[model samples]
Target chain A: MLVIGELINGMYQNVGKAIKTKDKSIIQKLAKDQTKAGASMLDVNTGPASAQPKDAIKWLVETIQEVVDTPLALDSTKADVIEEGLKLVKGKAMINSTSADDDKLNTLIPMAKKYNAQLIGLAMDKKGIPRDRNQRSELALKIVSACMEQGFPLEDLYIDPVVLPVNVAQAQGVEVLESIREFKLLSDPSPKTVVGLSNVSQGTKNRSLINRTFLIMAVGYGLTGAIVDPLDKELMDGLITAELLLNKNIYCDSYLDAYKKK
Target chain B: MAVDLLKEKWQNKVGTITIGATKAEGGTRASTVTVGGQSTLPFMFGEGDMPNKPVIAMEIFDIIPEEWPATLKEPFKDVMNDPAKWAKKCVDEHKAELICIKLQGTHFDFGNRSDADAAAAVNAVLEAVSVPLIILGTGDEEKDNKVLAKVSEVSKGQKCLIGDATDKNYKTLAASCLADGHSIIAESPIDINIAKQVNILISDMGLPQERIAINPTIGALGYGMEYAYSIMERARLAALNGDKMLSMPFVCFVGQEAWRAKEAKGPQSEHEDWGPESTRGPLWEFMTATCMLQAGGDILIMRHPKAVEETRKYIANLMK
Candidate 1:
């Protein structure tokens, strides 16, 4: 599992205050802690709190780099804010996302190519998240096709089926899983599949349980990466065990420890 | 125009395991044997790498066998009663690379010897052979738990490959191997899922993956050999395709299974067209070993000296 820590985003109270106050300590500590908790890449979002969002994204990216070497995921709705963070990353960065819309694809794919960043493509347009998996697959294919046309490597592209809160859109969970499986055939080398995992459990009482169960189901359908709370031990353990049973990892007594190291 | 070379690129390879610690590495053995680090199928040089050659270990028992045919027993008749002498004969005379000591004497159906006797036999063999040892416990589950644990403790750090731990009963033996720093042989009843599950179970008990091998219970020649081959082929393929739990080198007990076949032991009078029993028995064992090697067997345990010699020659030639 390519765990992208979802905790460092500016939506959280501590992160919002830190992003406003330009508090480097809080953001740096979260970066180090998330990396130690098994975040291969940290998702950096400036959220609605940042008045100067472009500068805040750069600050988050630079502040994270000073403490940990983990790659950054430049996250924002605005192209310039993402580009600001993308410019500062020393290593291969991830563009945390673009939608299937032509405008988003036109801007982000070129930007991803310029920065050599991995692009996460959500299967939705201005019409909103698709009601069925077929529409999702079609939108996901558009994203893959755009990357191919632009000469961006499909291996560096990730397709998100746009997971919804299961408490309301229960049937869409199945559609998302089917979309994950279908997304593999969009190209030869295949765009890796990822999901913002916490969305499935949003507004639910058993948040951890729902997130882990859905995560394993996604993994079974060949979802390669996930935006998740790496600090959630139960969720991480479930993911590690799921991969082990799928024969993706070599079994050792301390597989939980092993997966953390991996 | 230049032709592109045909090659296969696998994501993973079998785990390489070293058996028996040398004197410098904290054991008394003169040498150690390493097996199972192949990125490709057996002997497929063009596709990938088979880093280590398949090796053979001749089988001996704690007590002299009562079921051996005259043709099979002729080589080691002189040293039959003494376990240490029997192992020495295997290594000294036949140039055996590894010795597998079966604690058959401790079985309830056998003499029901004490665990102390089993430990003593292992000690004698460790003293007798400079090469690595593979100690196997008898299938008597209750007795094996008691006997193999003592044997594992007595031969601590010798790095002997001790096993026959299965899915049903493995905790005691796995813990013993972990405590004593010995490698283990996990046996599955010719099922790939069970094979993987057995590995996971043992691994869950604290033993590392490299210190384990899979004993996919084999079928002798003319008796479900193809079935055994298919299972091993799938396992090897899974391993190459990056399934880590199934990637341990295979350990096939060829001699014990082959000798049980009527083709290897039946008298000529029973089948008029069949060749002399003397050569037929060893040939059966050799053919079975050959089949296993092609199916990616890493350590083949055989009984006949002539068959072991032939397999060694074949392995040497195959490596070249």
Candidate 2:
């Protein structure tokens, strides 16, 4: 299970407050707890909470790395924030996004290459997120081709087919999973497939259960990882179960250790 | 000739797995049995040499199993109460090339037995049967670890095959097997991708490639066997076509799956077209085992002695 801890993002009120106040302790604590909790990568996002997202993102990346060795998934909508975070990161990190759109790819891919960072390419183009598998698959192939043209290793490119909320768009999850399956068939040395997992459970009553179930089903269709809160036990349990079912964890030997720690 | 191509170009060589170490090696078994090391598909003599034929293992229980059909129950009626005696019957009468002793007692619903009980059962069965042994856990994660860990320790240096390691429980079992120098059966639920992933995980833990057997769970005839067959075929093709990660020899649990299905155990009166339970049960196992062998199964774990006899005959005929 490749956990991309969601705690450092500016969406949460405390994290938002920390970004505004420039409280290094809050950033440091979130990073420390998430890393200690076994997050393979911590997501550092500074959205509208920061008047200067580029500066805030740089601060989070630097502070987090000071305490932990786990890699960062530099999450941002603004190119500047992503660029600043990528520049400050000491080692190879993951750029949380680029889209199938030529503009985003043109800007972000070069920065990713310059920083030697892995990238998450969302399955959306100039028209925005596709609602069907064929469109999603087309967008994925386009992004993958762009990455290839830019001389990126397929392994370094993660395809996110953009999971929509299940309550609002029931068919979207299945379509995305199908797209991922189709993408696996097309790409040699298939790029890792991931998703914004919380999108599937947004506004749902048992959000954790919904997210985890969808994750397992997605994994069955060849999803390699996801951006999710590592602290959610149900989601963690589902990941462990999916890893076992997919035979990614051999005999579930990791579950015993996870269970004991939990 | 095609043989020249095999010698010069084929990359798919099934690793030879020798079970049970003699005193000269490290363990205390009278002899060892080797399987795998096939340079071509099963019985494809014209394509390449079949360095070793698939081997048969009789499945014996550590405790009297209540769920087994009457046909199986009748054969071991006398020694079902004793694990050692039961194993001896499987080895001596069945002429089993290997013995698979399932530790079912560890899974009782009335709580569970201590690890020592499992260890004792393993030791007794090992002593009773001179043929190489395969130890299977109870399928429960925590309980299996407790029992399998103990069995691994007691059977150390024997070079046994310990498993049914699913993704959930592979780490401890793989670690235990690694430490004990025993091989393992990496069982997956009939998906080629999963089979490859599990193989990668086990290999990542530093277990030698020769010490692992992939069990891409086979279904009995009339029980989605075609799907299992296709998955195994695909897995074999991938390995042969040079996917180094998936090139391990395969093991099939033919008996456990075959007899458990309704087609094998139902009364003849209920499904007259299916024939008698006694005949259908062993035949189901035999046919399933044979199909898997043709699909490149390196080891078959069978329940009934008749199934073993029938399967051995089929293998011999194919080889001839």
Candidate 1, pairs of clashing residues: none
Question: How do the residues A1-262 of candidate 2 rate in per-residue lDDT, one tens digit apiece?
Answer: 4578888888899998888887889888888887766577898888665787777887788878888888999998888878888777887799989988898998888888888899999989778779799988888899889888988888888988899998999978779889879888658878788888998989999898888888888888888878888878767767777766665533333343332221
Say which docking band candidate 2 falls in. Answer: incorrect
TM-score of model 1's chain A: 0.98
Instruction: Indicate the docking level reached by candidate 1.
Output: incorrect
True A-B contacts kept by model 2: 0.00
In candidate 2, position A191 carries an lDDT of 78
TM for every model, in the order presented, reads 0.80, 0.55
Worst 10 residues of 1 chain A by lDDT: A253-262
List the lowest-lDDT window of 10 residues for candidate 2 chain A.
Answer: A253-262
DockQ for each candidate? 0.18, 0.02
- Which predicted model would earn the best TM-score? 1
lDDT of candidate 2 over B272-309, digit per residue (tens):
88878988888889889888988888899998888899
